[model samples]
Target: MSLSAAITGMGVVICGPKEIPDATGNTLSAISMAAQEAGIDLREIDGLLINQNELIADDHLTLDLSRRGAFGTLKVLYELESKGTTMSVLLKQATEIVNAGEADNVVVVFADAAISPNAPSGAAFASMGGDTGYRGLERAGGMLGAVAAYALIAQHYFVERNADIDDLFAVAQAQRSWAVENPLAWIREPLTREKYDAAPLVAAPLRRLDCARPVSGAAAFIVSKPNSSNSLNPVYVRGMAQRHTMRRRHAPHSPWRPVGASEVFTDALKQARTTADAIDNLQIYDAFTIVPLVMMEELGVVGPGEAGSFIAAGNTRHGGSLPVNTGGGQISGFYLQGATPLIEAVTQLRGQGGNRQIADASTSMVVSVGGRLESVNALVMGVQQ
Candidate 1:
């Protein structure tokens, strides 16, 4: 539905592979950075939303988040953790609160330090309850985490389409090209096919390069009523929708099963009075190399079993008809959960994309596929002229 809110400014702090002092502090600083751009002081923020991902990063403060931050008396405050979809959910909730006049100048922030020196490699997500779900069916799968999970989907997808596995690396290579141009991207080096093959295997089909590089990063966004005097060239929310297509604890019938992606895509675009083809850019929350294809196939952007060929044909690279993850996405860029795509889209729309900016691009469609691909959230945004 059309939202009567606009994003006024945003802030991001990306650190190296090590932990920074009070990772939560990074998030707070990001808020200050964003609020400054919005022409608002810390005391002016009446609402605050923070995505506390305990599973990914143990650095987040619990209820004491607001007390320890640089915010004022918050009329609305919540610390949400809904896997990766938390960013959009926070944004949507902030918009509603602003539009309803419950609060003004709300800021949503997210910070993570999953792959630090303190935490073992992949320790943050190693405890994920594999695809067996709540049923606990004896699949001999336990603590397989996300890489193994997506590998399962890739195995099914590639086998079904008889698609070459090299296409997966092609996506990594394509995203790396964009990352090469992104100053904030962690992996700026080109991902050659040889390097991909040489990379250590995370799962059967996924290599180290195929997975998102977890890093210590934080991002914050400020939103207020549409066209407020304090706002400047604000980004208006065109449409937003979210759907959870999963049982509470049941595993999907198929690994590549379509999660309510089409529903969110259709509803959000319809509310925006636009179509998928009209979208100038796509910012997909891609945690793995195969996610883009799964999303494209599920969204009907390309025919079933055809998304691989589409990307391998350079359809998603810069200067193509459609640029998916033009800012390198989470796979090649640093993984800050849903904040990766959300902030990237905002950066592009603000005409600050630097070398990776898409020319004449005014509209962006961001999709956050969360959980075990169970929750799908789609949002359409347009930059006000």
Candidate 2:
């Protein structure tokens, strides 16, 4: 008894390193924006799902957001932590709960204090998995952090496909070009190929520009029936799919092929009753520059070993065959995981992307990768015809 759902309201607030230090306050403000856009009182929201991994603090925020008034006695409130793909999972879960008549509207919120001074570095993630023997294995090989681990993958991708590192420059610069037009984007300074090439190396093949910057920010949205909202334009959630590789070390390595994206993308498109050609825009998880390069190949946007060449040719840039990460993405934008990308997708669909908006854009695809490519999730979204 799966139910159909649409995004009726969305809110986003991004603070820079010097701006503010309130993650909870930003999240509440975002939630208020969404409630305002949906033209619904806070009391009308019956379901609330917060992605715990993206939050900087306690589980009390959910209650705080819910206690404003009398919620539907059938309210649903919970915290979820699924790494980078938590937002998509929550979307699917909220839709199911709403369809079951247990809740009429579901509010999903995500906020992160990644940019906080005390936050751990990206290198830290690479070690947390050490408990599973990966640390010892990596230590034995002198590979210490996420940058080191992914650098190994990038090296493999280059050798196996005979690709050059310059291709990554193309990917980074393209996203930066889009970021320049995005006011909310963190990295707005022009990122040139020359600048990228000369950037300091974090690992052998991975440079400072290859990784996403952890920034404090918050984003939220409301999921409800299309007819139940006050908004004139609603983006329907056509389809979704999630898959995981479990142990990435055992997975095959390839540039044009992703670990689990093919299966997930295929299932999502099939469920949406659409094809790759129908998508006018793509909001890929660019946690790192290499993520989108491999995803483009996995989604069949380019042939095997053709991603580097395809990107270098500027086929994925704005005003090209396919525009991606129109809002700069995780690398150039704040790293709020999938939450930021999801908000950008909604912006594109709503025609609110003033400068970076795709012309006549109606359909968009969002893909989120987590756990060093071990987890993949995709969503097919479109405006109601």
Candidate 3:
């Protein structure tokens, strides 16, 4: 018999550079408050998970903020590196630890500050690929490389499907409209089709608006076993899958080759015993607009190269047939290294998502990709036992 774990509480703190001088301190406070709100005492927390890039040391989980009294004394069982794909791994680990009786409750926290030293240069263009020194794709500048790759795929997709650029602009404009109502989002200014068209191209065929912004912030959540009478409802980790592909630089010289995303997503759906139609909402990691566009095909949300039409028909916006990225996604929402989508999944399942909450979102799918599209993790989460 497998033991079950559920999320009991959540907290978020998104501060611009001017709001908090110490990013770590703000993150600690956010996690602590979120735990308290969820009715868990700080002392009751048996494990801590931190995913901030700067705070992660070689082998130790530092607790400088705790010594300063932000959170009470507690055991820090495990600490993982902060990467785009760390959140899903942390969630799996936390659940396993709790169900295994190694811990009764676990607190996972993540925070980032734009002012932090070693912040990636050329924030507009970053790559999922770590430093490999590829000829055309620079390591630190891989973000741009990803955009370039996506633009290439998008252009091919459009040409193959005979879709117009106006369809893509409609998706951007709709997400921007949703961003206006989300106070936590970084880019809330309403986007116009004209503005999206006029924006300078970051990479060929990829406009500046198509790329995600680098915003500073933190978010935290508490997980525990379910009790019959708990105040907060539970969201179960129904199924999950992860896969890795050959590094892009090492792959065959065919740009038209199908990436490995479709297999991973399909396996996750099969493991969950659910179909694409069963998913009420989706929280795909959107480092670039094309990321979700690719996912739309890979996840079977639409047929090959049909995502532009799907978006142009207003199918991905709120109240659409398949609502997506309700928290404005990384393109507009706080970018905490891809953890934001996981946090949003929890919030949406708990019915705590304000303003952007889907009408009856009981099940959500979160897909995270990392390392030059080499690694992928997919999770099927739901508000069920």
- Best model number under TM-score: 1
**What TM-score does each of the candidates earn?**
0.92, 0.89, 0.84
Per candidate, the number of residue pairs that clash is 0, 0, 8
239-330 per-residue lDDT for model 3 (tens digits): 78887666544436334333677777788788878887889888878776767776677667788768888887888888899888887887
Candidate 3 segments exceeding 4 Å error: 1-3, 52-76, 115-132, 135-164, 228-231, 248-258
Predicted model with the maximum lDDT = 1
Evaluated at residue 378, the lDDT of candidate 3 is: 85
Residue 279: error of model 2 in Å?
Answer: 0.7
Q: Rank the candidates by TM-score, best first.
A: 1, 2, 3
Please, what are the lDDT tens digits per residue for candidate 1 over residues 1-385? 5446788978899886665535677888898888878888888888888887755535664567678776678999888887788888888788778888999889888887676666755776676543455523423545367787788878888887787678798789889989999999988998888888999998878888889887777898998864444545678677888887764434645656656788889999998888777898999999998888888888888888888888888989988878989889988888889999988888888788888988877899999988668888898988742
lDDT agreement with native, every candidate: 0.81, 0.77, 0.70
Clashes of 3: 8
lDDT of 1 at 164: 64
lDDT order, best first, reads: 1, 2, 3
